[model samples]
Target: MKMLRIISYAGLVAVAIMLLVAMCAILEDSVISHRAHRQELTGSTLSSPGLDHFS
Candidate 1:
């Protein structure tokens, strides 16, 4: 009985760790994509004809 209980606790802990790692990876990817999108928007606006008139 004790061995079974230990195994159950270990499995739960392993699952928790895996979930935490997955969440971190997802968050990192989201942040990188957001930064890239912002850069893309800025690049487009900078190339607009109106901005060229200012130069």
Candidate 2:
């Protein structure tokens, strides 16, 4: 019983960490896209900024 409880706790912790990492990655992607949009509007970086530029 004791070992099972420890394993369950570890599993939960691992899942939580994975979720946190995924969330951060998504947020980073959005931030990068937003910045690219801003640069496009300002016309400072590329004249023809397309979808490929963001990715």
Candidate 3:
């Protein structure tokens, strides 16, 4: 029983770490895109808009 309890706790910790990693990745992507947008505004880069209002 003690071993099973320890295993369960370890599993939960692994899941929590995975979730944190995923969240960090998403945040990093957003930050990178925001920086790119700034460059675009300054004419250092160009990218097409992803969507239009008419659709």
Task: Choose the strongest candidate by lDDT.
Answer: 2
- Candidate 2 local lDDT, 14-50, one digit each (tens): 9999999999999999988887778878888854546
Clashing pairs in 2: none
Give the residue spans of candidate 3 off by over 4 A.
45-55
Give the per-residue lDDT digits (tens) of candidate 1, residues 1-55.
Answer: 9999999999999999999999999988987776567658787533445544322
Q: Say which candidate scores most in TM-score.
A: 2
- TM-score for each prediction? 0.77, 0.78, 0.75
Q: Where is model 2 more than 4 Å wrong at Cα?
A: 46-55
Candidate 2, residue 38: Cα displacement in angstroms equals 0.6
Worst 10 residues of 2 by lDDT: 46-55
The lDDT for every candidate, in the order shown, is 0.76, 0.83, 0.77
Question: Cα miss at 44, model 3 (Å)?
Answer: 3.2
Among all windows of ten consecutive residues in candidate 1, which has the lowest summed lDDT? Answer: 46-55
Off by over 4 Å in 1: 44-55
